[model samples]
Target chain A: MTITLEPGRPKPMPTPETKHFWDGAKDGKLLLQRCGDTGRAYFPPRPFSPYTGTRNVSVFEASGRATLHSYVIHHRPVPGFTPPYAIAVVELEEGPRMMTNIVGCPQTPEALPLDLALEVVFVPMDDAISLPLFRPAATPAAGRTGVSMGVE
Target chain B: MSYVPGSVAVVGAAETTHLGAVPNLSEIGLAADAALNAMADAGLKPGDIDGIAWVGAMRPQLLAQYLGITPRWVDGTSVGGCSFMLHVRHAAAAIAAGYCNTALICHGESGKSRIAGAQRPPEPATLNGQFEAPFGPFGPPTLFPIPVLRYMKTYGVTEEMFATVAVVQREWAGKNPRAMFRDPISVDDVLNSRMIAWPFRILMCCLVTDGGGALILTSADRAKDFPGKPAYILGSGESVETGMISQMEDFTSSRAFRVAGPEAFKMAGIAHADVDHLMIYDAFAHLPLYGLEDLGFVPRGEAGRYIMDRNTAPGGKLPMNTNGGGLSYTHTGMYGMFALQESVRQVRGIAPAQVPDVDISVCHGVGGMFGASGTIIFGRDRPS
Candidate 1:
């Protein structure tokens, strides 16, 4: 017997509130809105500061480095996705709570190590947009060539 | 918390036909039917109503138009399965405060049949719909079952414990002619029922009942003037926790009850043992178990044990869900309304299937996904 995996469909167009994030993903970057003055990160991507009560905000690219806080293994498929998947809440290094999927590994509690290091991977849904998911990054050798960058 | 001891009198209570599927009726139509019946039950005309509160899937504006009232006060709190109970508390407080002389709390839903072509309600912007909705949890059966599974794991409870609740509720329903599933059921039957979700057999979940229920509240002094029997709402309380299902603190604990139960009991000036009858929203079987434990009816995590003792069944110590609940009776979508209606009826001594010597009735409704909870303690007399 053989098993085949079905590819999921991506979102068609970005809404006015989410265009910047989707556009950044197309450029191979994970974008988040950070307060220009207070340096606080906002989610559900709002125009004004949910915190600090300041209107100064900017869309900045994220490092997508985070720790796995907690997650659940869903045995059934949701709209636009395959079943037997892991849906997790990742606590980004920047201190924002994000809901995303875990990938590139078995979807089980044993394989999903809590507080494990992760890196972002972009999975394109439609022609013009994609999503930023995270997975376990490859461990480097004794002398690694590339240094990871962190944005201020 | 010291104010004049006020009373919330249920001068009116009404419902649609106690049967299955009434699809042709719009949400507003059903609400109107219930509101009118309630007014008639109270022996008051539509013109006498000065306040309105509703709970259901329908938007507030739509229900307002259905009731044909431009009231001085209005509340449309849609708390999933347990909204109607919440409305009773709100209506009671509003009546006590003199916000309105006559207030009506109404609920209606075509659970057996939804609007054929109506668009799906839009999800809130704050929700992580993109991430959460994709995991086969768009509705109640899937979302509610998660907590039940976790509770069983934490307490080391078994499906049989939950089945005990279902069997007992079904037995009560067997006596209720209005119950959708009145046939007698056994624990073995519940265990063998089809699985709606993990650990929740179809028998464990509420039936898709199509109906509506309404209650009219008035001040204690004003209630004495009414013609029909009046059930006094002696005390009421409400509490809410994290709104998102993904953000709930712990599946094993209920934040809403921890907050609301004490406040309600305190206001009622009664202990848990004082309650005569319990009419809890039976959206799912686990809810009553959670309610029993959360409201201090029994110790925490002992809900399974308390229920397993065969207490909630017919002739047991605590006769709960006497109307059969959504599991057997008509859920009517917003089941809280039914719970409140039953509570008022039980206290007024006019209920269709009366519980014996019922002077006090505690009505509870948990809206959202354990997100919010409300309780109203009713009695036959106002505190002297």
Candidate 2:
């Protein structure tokens, strides 16, 4: 028996509201927007604070530490992903949560326990895109290299 | 204040005759079939429908043209499967206010066959595509269940507890001939049913089928005149939280469900004990858990125990998902329509697996992945 995999993963296209966040990822930094009015951090960066809709916001480096909030070990095969990989949501230490894959660790229930400590790692796809994926904090070297450059 | 409680009634309801696998039919054809069936149930014709509301791939323009009736009111609200519930709510308001004397809300999706259905996965530019999809989730099987682990951790809920939901629903399905998977399934069967997503075995997910359902609404004054007994709309409400599942306010409770459920309860002026039959959308097994608690059927963090007690099973108190729900019954992608259809049947005292002496039936639906929600309460008698 033989198996084939899909060619490439879906890449995020940078829009006006999210260019800075993607740029930060390309450089191996997790960037989030902080609302100037409330001094609160938000994810999936936008031009203004979602809480008050004030343009008083600034981009900053995130500590890249997050707890494994919840996840599903997906078994269905698709073009760009291997079966039985973990698709997860990690709650950033900064308060807001975001979606990312948990790599550098086994994708099984026994291995990926809830609240497992994770840190950020960037996978460069092309010159312009790199997806920010998460990995176990203790074993960053265990997972394969990133698949993209974070830009576009 | 213009909307009156119990001012409108669902005079007719019908699901397309050809459900499960009808390969020859297009999405629009399924909608038309359901629309006509619903109208016939009401003893009505195209000319009798003054307002039309729909949700799905089929545009309302094409539907109006195909049905050959120009409705004075139109609604094409597409939020998810629960969009049909919202349509019913909007149509009820329109009918009560004289915007339209009669309203038709229909849903038809070729979810299983994809006949003439254009695949509209989240775009690369959309929030989902940019943030969630890039992580390699092949849509709902991966996305919808993402909140379970955190929910379990926060509320002491175990996988076995939610898995019991699938078991109990299958018990209800065992009696309904139209249900897709009717065999009595045990919790072990659900746990062992081939994992599609972690915490969600295939049995715990909705069955992909081809079907459509439609409802006809008129003023409560004309309720009993229809061929089918009318189910009066006691109250209805809808609310939204977030487009991105990760951004959901809390992992355990759905903000949309919490908001929509209570609003409907308040509008209906009914308490939890007043509900005789319940239909909570079960696109995935965990939904009923959220619906039960968020709708105030049980205290928070106790829905798991509530189902485990078999309170929602056949011959149990607060009978739920009596048509087997999306899990055991037919799930045509956006299953809110089917949920609404079953609630109407139960309230009209005509369900296939009829619960005895049902007066009020509450149908609750989750639209997106915990993003949008709608609730509708129906009753056998007019509001006081």
Candidate 3:
């Protein structure tokens, strides 16, 4: 059976608070906001420090390094995704977690162990949009190529 | 403040007359049907209900209007599938505080048919839409399994141990004539089922059905007037931790579950050994494992073994998910209502898979991906 990916997958609508992060992804940079007062960094790029409710925050370029916290290799067909792909949550080096897919490795338990080192790879979806997916940092040669560039 | 144990009781409880596939009833219609059935069970009328509570698609006003009643107190606490459990807690508190005399809590979902309306598409700019949605996470099947996988790795929980949950629940399902899928399943059956997500197969997921359930609450003193045997609300607890699964305090343990379970146990002044029947909302196979450990029924990391040993099966010491649970019974998106109904049935000695001489029952629920939790303890006899 020829698997045609569903086209209705959701895309991020860039709001003022989150536009910077999306723009950063387009520029091949992983951007996270740091609270100016507490120096605590957070993910999903919020408007303020969730811990202290401080509006004093600024964006910084992330190291693009993260550890695989947890994931599931979804075999069911989802819109904009082929069957049998990994859906993962990775904890960034800066002490915050973000949801992303782990690319560049087999979507198997043996290949995607807990705390596996991963680096971000920018997959461009459109002229102004790109998504940051993760791949095992050590296996650059195994990185996925020529796949559809859309949300999972 | 700690709850006054046994101040309120569930006078009536019921699910829709026909579960699984009822294409005739819309989501709201199912809610009304269940509410009417429950009211009839309690020998009550629409005018007798002074408070109304519900979660998911149907609003309280809409449900009340459909039933031709205007409630003075209303609760629409949508904390995912466990919202109905929270409704019971809130209704008990409202009844205790004289906010309302008779409280009706209802839940209805057309999860299989999508007849109520298409599922709401997430706003792209919302927190989940921005962070989690972009990753192509496909609802609970994709998101929930991630944590269970981690839990397995951390606790040495094997695939066979996970399959035991589905197998045991199916055993309970086989006994219930109303259960959607009642065929007995083995561990090998669950293991061999088609994989939906890694470490999760078709057997691990709950059934998609269109149904609803309702419960009526009143002061314990008025319980004897109702035709149905009362399941006295001994204690209740509720808590929320996060909206996203990725942001949960820990993948293995749900903070909300930890807080909700012990609080109910403390309020009821009951020990773990006192629980005669248990209903842990089993939307997925791994949920009961978390519920068991978090509710202090077993030690952390031992629930997998506890199930594998047939401790929660039909003839086991602790009868759990006696209505076949969301797994094999009816799951209309929000499954807590059915869990509550089964607990009441077990306490009243009318459950299809009835456990003999049950006196106390605990109904524990998880909303979202461990986002919220509500736990309620029920007793056959009123507290002194």
Docking quality band of candidate 1, CAPRI definitions? incorrect
Docking quality class, candidate 2: medium
Candidate 2's C-alpha runs over 4 A off are: A1-6, A139-152, B56-58
DockQ, each predicted model: 0.13, 0.70, 0.65
TM-score of each: 0.79, 0.95, 0.94
Q: Write the per-residue lDDT of candidate 3 for residues B1-384, one digit (tens) a residue.
A: 656899899999989988888899898888899999999999999999999997744577888888988898899899988998899999999999989999999987888877774367568879888778877887888887778877987899988988888889888999999999999988899999999988899999999999889999999989888888999999989999988898886888999999999999998999999999999999999999999999999999999999999999988999899888999998988899999999999999999999999999999998988899999999999988
Weakest lDDT window of 10 consecutive positions for candidate 2 chain A: A143-152
> On a 0 to 100 scale, what is the lDDT of residue B117 in model 3?
40
Best by DockQ: 2
Model 3 pairs whose backbones collide: A152-B136
Off by over 4 Å in 1: A1-123, A127-152, B1-6, B56-70, B116-126
The TM-score leader among the candidates is 2
Candidate of highest lDDT: 3
Locate the minimum summed-lDDT window of 10 residues in model 3 chain B: B113-122
Taking the candidates one at a time, how many backbone clashes does each contain? 3, 14, 1
List the per-model TM-score of the A chain: 0.79, 0.85, 0.84
Off by over 4 Å in 3: A1-8, A36-38, A139-152, B56-58
- Candidate 3 Cα lDDT to native: 0.87
